[model samples]
Target: MFAENKLTDDMAEIEAFLVRERAKVLSEAEWKFRMRGYGYNLRRTNGGVEVARLPQNTVLGTLAL
Candidate 1:
């Protein structure tokens, strides 16, 4: 649905969309901290930083497929 050209990659676009979704879900402080790490940090907390992986084909909500 977001193809800009005939050869555009849909999975790349979908990944970008998911990144945007994750950004939107984070708080302002969390966003700033995350941006400071060059988008490397996945789990940010008072305990410690931990990298996390999301499952494939995972639905976020009723609005998400």
Candidate 2:
């Protein structure tokens, strides 16, 4: 049916959007890890992937104290 097809198309579009957003997050994480000595981790959850930044030992890190 037309409604079913429309639903499928909508699902595909949503999936594509999530993929793009995930890619962007990964790219930014990679850049930060490489250029700024930042640490990161990607974990899978019931909802979706979670991008987390690990603590880094930096001058600025201590300044926050």
- Residue-wise C-alpha lDDT for candidate 1, range 1-65, written one tens digit per residue: 22232332344553454356456755746653543343322444554333322323222222122
User: Each candidate's lDDT (Cα)?
Assistant: 0.39, 0.35
After superposition of all CA atoms, the RMSD between model 2 and the true structure is 15.9
Any residue pairs clashing in model 1, and if so which?
none
Per-residue lDDT over 1-65 for candidate 2, one digit per residue giving the tens place of the 0 to 100 score: 01222432243443443344446555745533442332324344565444343453211111000
Cand. 2 TM to true fold: 0.27
Q: What is the lDDT of candidate 1?
A: 0.39
Model 2 misplacement above 4 A: 1-9, 27-65
Residue 56 error, candidate 1, Å: 13
